[model samples]
Target: MKVYKQAKIVHETLKRLRVRIDWLQRKLIDASHISTLVERMEGIESARVNKGAKSVVIRYDGKPETRLAVLDFLDRLEPTNLPYVQQSNSEEKHFFHASLNGLALAASPFLTPGQRLALAGALVAPTIWEGIDSLFSGSVKVELLDAIAIGVATSRGDAITALSTNFFIHLGELLEAKTNNNSNALLRQLLHPAPTSAWKEQNGELTKVAADQLKLNDVVAVNPGDTIPVDGQVLSGTAQVNESSVTGESVPVNKEAHMRVLSGTIVEEGTLRIRAVKVGDDTTTARISRFIQDSLENKSETQKKAEKKANQRILITLGLGALTFLLTRDFTRVASVFLVDYSCALKLSTPVAMKSTMYKCAKNGILVKGGQVIETFADIDTVVFDKTGTLTHGELDVIEVESVQPQEWPKDRLLALVASIEEHSTHPVANAVVTNAKAHELPHINHSEVNFIVAHGMVSEVNGKRVVIGSRHFLEEHENVDIAPYEELIIRLENKGLILLYTSMDSVLTGVIGLRDQLREDAKSMIDRLYANGVARIAILTGDRARKAHALAEQLGIKEVYADLRPEEKAAIVQQIKDQGRKLAFVGDGVNDAPALVNADVGIAMPQGADLARASADIVLTDDNISGVAEAYEKSRDTMKLIQSNFKWAVGINSGLFVGASMGWTSPVVSSLLHNGTTLGVLARALSGVRER
Candidate 1:
């Protein structure tokens, strides 16, 4: 090994210093030791060492003299005489030997006594060490049980029994580890890194550069079928972008100049030149990935309960085994009682089942943030849906147009005048009017300067006549246009759940346009399914008028409707429902729905929902289908049932074995076989997943 005196500092400030080591590849242990030493020094706040990159960064709050002393101490330090270590496939090797040892003990008659003893001793060493450590630390668990079983058998000079007990314990450990590792591997596949290269605009030309090299305001050129590497606004060009990875929208949205695009969205067609606004870890994809990782680390209440139950059962089993030994005075009987404990299977199978089901849900385009959300989903009794985007399509369609005076203005002419004014606005109602006009092939009319009044109608001059098109309140209250003649018609249209847009030409009321947002095709079926799956109450919360919300709710057979609610009012309704002791779940897809989504027991977001809504939701539907709510609920329920069954089997079988062993009705070999066999069986069922009906 080469030792250096006074390593060169790469960067330094008053409170931090970064240094590079010449050779530290794959030397995690040495790097950890150095980091620990530096961290223990006076006035050093923290030290981080990266063994792979051979670098260290130290954060200190010391004076200049202390900093110099630290540098001098580093220069005088000598390398330890530790062996150069390389990574090894030790787990695989251990599993292989464990299998062979288990086989040898199962066929003990063919092996000599000395070979069996050696195998037993080797197998029990780790368990004994763990048990001793736990005892010294004032905690005892399942490890103590296994250690006692093997130690008692060894003291009785029964080599075959000792080997058999240790063998089964090791086998069970291997199986549990394998199952958990596989589940984690599947969950990790959800987050993938971005591509390596991007076409960057530099010096009036496009050049290929690494994705990580992108900086703010640096324009990047993207082509068809390319993933957007950064979140930015389109400087030029247009495309159909698929934002399913980040926003969970199934359909590709049309993007044009001045429109914003997010990172991880794909360009299905056309090209786009985007200026990088947020790159690398600041992107939406990165945030979701971090959320998922954090969620995985947080366990559910059900898992914690199972763990606690298992720990309590271990203590009871240990006391029972000691009592049995004292009364019977037989080491073999004590060994038998100690061979079985409930902690292993109960702890391993619950999480395995949850994670496996979560992976399946993700594959089906449902992203559940964590197991706790799944548990809460299964418990929800009341399901609340936002009316606009959750129950019906958020897009508006022009259904009908009528001229107030057919003799004065023809229907086509009236529509053309209204559409010409509405085309200048980007509102949803405006888009519907313009779309309907284009479908009817109405010619565009030339108009003077158009003025848009916020939350009111637009005013402009069409062919030397004044034109106004907007809501009835906007026309009557704001523009002072007389709409007294069409009050009956407005009332009828409003009763039919249609939004009306009034038009005035030359200071005379001309016509009214009716627009309606259609209910989703699966809305009724989804509601029925949710009810069938044990949802006690299904309600609608909307910012729409009372008549509109009631009209749509009646169609879907939903009785409870909260209308004209502000964002905070929706959250208040959720809190009221929750206060009644009903577990509630809110499904929404708009920024206004974010408060309610956050207030519910579980929040579900549609794929096409706003980013804020998705972030507030616990579950996100990737296909933007409302029916996924039922699917997620049913899946969570089934996963919980599977967990319960596994828990029952683990406890029932272990208790039975413990009772038989205490009464001296089972031998040590039989006890180990039954206990490990039950654990393996439960694990197999968990990994196999909930059965499909």
Candidate 2:
């Protein structure tokens, strides 16, 4: 708290606070870090630090508690408290190793045969060491095959062949290393968690600090709307926590003192003080996020198969080389036989294709999380979409307004009355009504105390008449309003996928408001494109009623539909589809969709989706465009197609060369050039799209 003692509050307001710090004049503290730290606290919007005036200005949401929290954070921050950022130079390592290998190859013509052989040996030392290590370890792999080939070339004083083979091997290493590094970097960006801070309660006082700084056994205070920062037992207070991210449950669980709580769950209501038993990287959120990050290193089935094929081919090459040398007593044939293995192209082409496609997808506003996701997308047979946000605009709009009794209540007046009542609540349907009324410049009508009912509607007294605005169930059943006369109109609207809100005045139906999500203009076209690209089945899942969900599916020409489902039910359906031996992809955009997103073979999250949804998804569209899913599907197939083509080309040509060398038909120089030439050519084809302009 050394820095805190020297700082003073200079100006204060409901939404803005300015603080003076003396150390900023001397450049002793990191102002950028301070701004980022304070701005992440709940209710804070921005923090600007001024090094010249030695002051920090913070703008926060207009909440009294938020103002207190900002000051608390600044008061507890110390001079030594700043996050350390490490810089990565894998790109530099790639360049440096590449320069050395390039020099060895390019300078070969200027040296004598003996000098060339010596230099090639130095350059190929690592591969030879790896081969010797693998030899003792009793494993036959591509590295051992490559080392033996180069070793035979050197033993026979064939420097050009030795240098050529070693150079191409290094080239493939550089390609795979560079691609893996860049993929991991992009995944890190997409997997970053929401800004987090915690309130540490010690000795009867609360202090705000970065969540990562929390220690085991530290007591933390969490409020409504705050993400819980630890996996621990609640020390005091009570709250309802949404554990959907972990348990896949739609309902928030009630938590009280002595109950256990997990990190990443949000406090929906009330407050709680928790004692942290696990902190920092040990928490569940970090572990799950790490699981996502592990995708960067985990190889896909295609990559494994490629490496397996390469390793299996190594034994064939070694056996052929030994047989030829034993039969003909010729070292040249032995070197040619050893150099003609299919290891290089088979092992390197898959990574090159995967990395190139990832870069392409990123540029096209799609982020394929890993090579595994790309592999899955290549074979995806089924696609499931969340109805509201995935297929149509998540925002509801007023499609039509009709008055049941026009003689007593007109449409405009009904809209205004509904808007006035609905504006008091913040539901999506209510917001649409309020927005439509405002667009027409309608004034708010005076009403009695508005009572908001959960999952029903709004009720109040307007002009001394009991007025209710809600659904058919709320008005007809709950309020005893008679709406049996307009049953046909209701049915027609529901058939068209319009969600209706019924209004009643004094036990009589007065009006109906039809609200519906506007379908994305390209939705149908996107579906058609999916079908054209070989998707076998398409379906929709929604929490909406069966009528509305069916109406949307029919409009989109989709035959399969699941409706009125909770979050867990949606996930169950996804698993069921997957269990049928169908390769499925699920697209979603809400916090409740996390479970299904996780369960699908490949999950695609819309860019505007909630944090948990994006984190759970394997593929994320970086833009709002829904058609990117179709684009990604096409790209994945093309990349896999390229890999397969290269696999065939490598095997077909190298097998011919191996047979020629066994018959002493192809020389060592011809074998090395043709083998490395095809390997480099296919690798170039795989990386053709990834080149920067």
Candidate 3:
């Protein structure tokens, strides 16, 4: 009823202000009311209340009156007058109380007869209320069955039996709730950013504040081993930042002034001051977290089918129980039939298995977005891979550099001239050339202004002579360079899966640079294993020329190849394959692969992929290992098998119980114990992983 502390200004701007509330008691309802009041005020754009964090961030138009009104409202607010909000810990307390009640009922034999009846009645009260509510709502579910069994026993003067039945059911319900809560908590932890404080710079003085309090343009100092709290640009100092958490790149990148740093990345060595460009929810970490949370909204087809079957079984069980009572004329037999319903196990076990499997997959460096993706992944008959990164290492290596006109230029001189011209470009081929030049310790040559042609190459004047360096198509056709004399060498390189970069000096073909991206070490073995695992077809979809694409496919033993396709074209290929009634899984790791990734039945992304590509993917290989594609498929298939096995056990055991009860071999008490025991057994098996690691 009292404010623990006055509201503190955590963030402020011309049009927004965020205040952290220190409540004497957790007051979610008061926070909600405060948010509503702030939104109703004039000039207020929006107000978000975070009950968990006990804070309200308000966005408003830049007006002095609006700011004054907000301050006045806060100053006059009285916590004692506001509605109280129950804390989340109350749910745990409720569960504890239910557990204690069950335990007390189990010990009822030690109490007096009147005390035993009172305890039984108290335990059955909630079930009766729930059954009546379901009747009014025109729904007959597991609750109705529990109520019927307990009511039948109590009417026959078997209060102990009724209380024991209710206790076991309540215990099962508690366990189910606890399992789901733990699963959800584990998932949230995977995506939630850990709370940390940031050193905020204001007026040339550094003060420690909550990381969430950082606003745009605020400067924060990061030391070695500190996780960067916001996406920002380095203002000063240098460091080697490990970006594996975000980009999945294992190697640490040396970051200096003006370099951009992402949130959630750790600075391995060195210290730096960074200016925040995107803070809180606007940062990359927030976006990934939101994406993960939203992914849970999609339920798998298997889950949907299981839920539907469970509901239908509930109605069937009620009818069967009624028919057994009419035929036998015995209340105990009816109670037995009502006690052994299969719906509870059927409904609860499937989701538990899915969530547990997903958690395991995350631990193994695979991020499956939802249960549906897992189901679909297991069913996929074909897998389409993008060649550049999925099938081969994306990093290009310069294998050969040769001068066509040796009389005019030697190989090293030609390499130096090419590297100098490509120095200003960030293209993969340019990087390969520059890296090769540096490895050979080639001298740097001076060049004039370089003109870059998109998707082709670059042109510049070296030593007062025009020098052109680009793709074969660009140099020969666009630049009118003569490459016919070197056709034999070019053909040989092309056949060997080498990408050629042609260079021309003074309008004459001078040199050719051959670059080759090595196939991933596991690519061939992975493809072989996919086939062995019943993948009907394996194919490669790439933007590379047919010769290059085909050569790699041959090496990997993949028969199908689609070459020289753009982003849209790759997606079209995926659609065409899917139209053939085949479930397809597409694996890719680049910005250009986003469309195809979205178009496929299940998209698998490698680590170190572009943000958009990773976001669009259904499964992410967090370890950057291509082998996870196979591991995911196997895991999903095993998970499905486990679910089906659980289903069979539930049905087989319950059916036996039903027969035994009809023949008067089992009473209501025995039936209730057996039913709950079988269900819990199935749930335990479901929670255990599909296979041993």
Candidate 4:
């Protein structure tokens, strides 16, 4: 068994060595053109002083056929007397010795066959000869014999030798490992496998459905800590979802049945069984994932154009280098240049930079989902916004209520009654009513049998009295309450973008409470800054009526408005802007704006939005500030610029080295060192982050 184990170890080493030899042989063979130079050039001349003090007759003829003529002369020379050859230059001394050295060494009887073969091959192979030249040529030189020994060590599989040859390879693999594992892990995870979703069989069948099939009402289920797989309505159970990955909100939210959830959100609590109203490809989650994948697969238009130019330039240079090498028979130098020029730098740099920039944005609470989004932000001709909650604080302020029977019920009692009924509802309206009621110090009403109406209002019995609080239409249609006269008050609030709710007791109008969504403190300033940052236009799209949307748009200096838009309509509007040569970025609390979010060049979600929207957006704002958008753009532009610079340096150095090598100005050792240096330099530069403005 021990013998068998030893045999196995030897076999494995042999196999590994075989692989290395194959790789080296392939590369060296590709470089063999350089070795022919020695066979094609020759020195034959005699120039010396005679004792008679007469000018010595020096015969010299340097021509392309000189090497052939010298060979013919050698074949005819007599072997009886001692042969003495003369040379005119020191370079010729080394060149002549190199050619004859192999034959002389091979003729020796003392040296082993392996040693003889190795020495003979070294004399003729440009690679080996160049190694000698490198070590002996300049001030920055090692001994010629030392270089040969090192090259032998490398060829013979010495660990240190392998390390020297593989410096750039190992460094690149290490840096790529670090990058793929840490900062860009998320993007890499999404991109590395090409997604099981995009997998295709040999047959023409598609493996996955497109994303748009997923709908809001679909039943979906995702376990704890898992990303929400699809967008759907929660049918049962409660859990806190960490939407920060999608929406940039660090805080987790409590979500229950009937609440809409999005994809890419992590479930932080109890299991949820959701009803998938949309499935297959149309779902919002699928669309968002599709966008991310597409962004990764497709370069921006500008990048594609740049790559085309770069590729053409590289091809032209390679062609020129090849032609020159063939004409001059300078195979040694040709090999050096070919080894140094790799297309990876130009091909990979920009995409990596863009990916890293996007990650940086995620770190700072902004998530730009795709390359398209980053490019779009760089050219945002117009900006649009939703008024309520987006521009305004989204919090409702309750100042006062005009009671129908002022003497009959105190305002505090009426608000308390309304708040008790609204406690079970989760809408912004409910929160406003509840907060205002608490602030007034009104006695809490013990309410029972509460019922909620989706997108409308709520109802409950307080002290055996039917209390109602909601939209006027909700009360008038459901309870047969007369709300015509209340229209005047509703109109007044509507013009200011405030949603009005009517309160009634047993079908009798008690009073009307006006709820206003206050403006965010930073709304105007953030919008102005976005404008100053080269944003060309700003607009708002919302489900609310035009009057209210327009009112808030005016306040925020927005010039465009689209109100009372269904989710599909909003998406169409976004598409329209995109069609008009403007890159649209939709920022919303994800719940009601999903389609539009997906339609925009970039979907930006706030922490407060539904999980689905966060997942749909490329960028999530952690602090929910609009200014984060601009900051993200700045980082992206800078990172991309660095990527371009890295490519330029990488390609430039390699191309320059190729020229140097071809001219015989560079030796094997120098070329190898340069190749390693250029590659490592490019990677290092790419890793460096952009400076802050």
lDDT of 3 by residue, 558-622 (tens): 99999999999999999999999999999999999999999999999886678788889999886
**What would the per-residue lDDT of candidate 2 be over residues 218-269, giving only the tens digit for each residue?**
9999999988989889989999998755433557989998878878788999
Q: List where candidate 1 sits over 4 angstroms from the true fold.
A: 1-112, 115-119, 209-218, 232-262, 267-270, 275-278, 323-329, 406-417, 440-455, 459-467, 477-481, 589-594, 606-612, 659-667, 691-693
TM-scores of the candidates in the order shown: 0.79, 0.67, 0.77, 0.56
Clashes per prediction?
0, 0, 0, 36
lDDT of 4 by residue, 1-693 (tens): 212211111112211210011121221121111111112212435322222222122233545344333333322222121111111112223434434543443354666656554554444344345546764665212122223433444455332322232332233434443443233334432211101111112244433322233444544455575456565678788999986645557789899988877555668888887665545354443444444444455566655755665555555545655775787875445544444444445544555666666656655656466666677677666666655556766777775576777787777777777887787887777788888877777777788888777777777876677887777888888888997876776677677766678888898888877776777777787788777767787888888888878877888788788999887888888888888988777888747777877887777776556767766776766555766766866676666668667866876787787678677787544665676566556655554556655
lDDT at 164, model 3 = 75
Error of 3 at 82 (Å): 22
Given candidate 4, what's the lDDT at residue 112?
65
Tell me, by TM-score, which candidate is best.
1
Report the error of model 1 at residue 343, Å: 1.1
Please give, for residues 1-693, the per-residue lDDT of candidate 1 as tens digits: 334464657788888988776554443244544665566454678888765566778888858744654565455444442211212213344487577667767777776887777766776677777777877888778888888888988777688777777777777677667666666555555554454458899899999776767998989999986778898899999899997665456789999998888877889999999988778776655655655565556688899998898888889888988899789998888888888889888887887787787777776678888889888999989999999988888889887888987886788888888888889899999998899999999999899999988888799997788888888888788778898877898888888788888898877899998888868989999899889989999999999999989988989999999999999999999999999999999999999999999999999998667879988999988665777888889989999999999998888888889989999899888898888889888988887777654
What value does the lDDT take at residue 382 in candidate 1? 97
**Native RMSD of candidate 2 (Å):** 12.2
Shift of residue 64 alpha carbon in model 1, Å: 46
Clash count, candidate 1: 0
User: How far does residue 540 in candidate 1 sit from its true spot (Å)?
Assistant: 2.8
